[model samples]
Target: MNPPDNPSANRWLVTACLAQVQAMRYTPAGLPALDMVLEHESQQHEGGGERLARASIKAVAFGPLAERLARQALGSCWNFRGFLAAGRGGKGLVFHIQDMQNT
Candidate 1:
């Protein structure tokens, strides 16, 4: 038996506080675009003990979602649903947010 290739597991979701929101911009295609950093902190059980997990990730949203996100205040918490992908110019990872809601 061979393992099947499955990329559907690339989905990512997290609840985090928004910070450093850039001014709304338009893409070459004229779609609204927004970029920002997300700060996440939570406690999780690890090694039978509680541990704090913290991270800061780069995130971007486009189109109507971007327009909506642009209106959100910094430091606001949101539940973000997205997928990870290599950032433009193939540098590091970027969270391409598909949808989000206030947390």
Candidate 2:
């Protein structure tokens, strides 16, 4: 089956620590951008079983979000709301962060 052009359920919100943060950059459009890695570790119930889930995902933020994230220290915890998408010319998933807040 063919998929929708823009899937509505591709959203992801994870409260994770900033494992790493790269220097900020600007897109060709002159929008501020920052790249970072988020680490999430928690216990979750899956298939009626308890499991310890740990994940590390690459994330990018733009505009004001990028400016805000740039000042955050590594290892700081925040609740990030974003969507999943393929990395730029890379493999696996990359989180496109839109909003974030301290937890």
The most accurate candidate by lDDT is 2
Q: Write the per-residue lDDT of candidate 1 for residues 12-31, one digit (tens) a residue.
A: 99999887788898889899
Worst 10 residues of 2 by lDDT: 1-10
- What are the Cα lDDT values of the candidates? 0.91, 0.92
Count backbone overlaps in model 1. Answer: 0
Error of model 2, residue 53, in angstroms: 0.3
lDDT of 2 by residue, 1-103 (tens): 6877877778889999999999999999999999999999999999999999999989999999999999988899999998998899878889999889889
Report how far residue 78 has shifted in candidate 2, in Å: 0.7
Error of 2 at 30 (Å): 1.0
For each candidate in turn, the TM-score is 0.89, 0.89
In Å, residue 46's CA in model 1 sits off its true spot by 1.4
lDDT of 1 at 10: 79
Output the lDDT of residue 20, model 2: 94
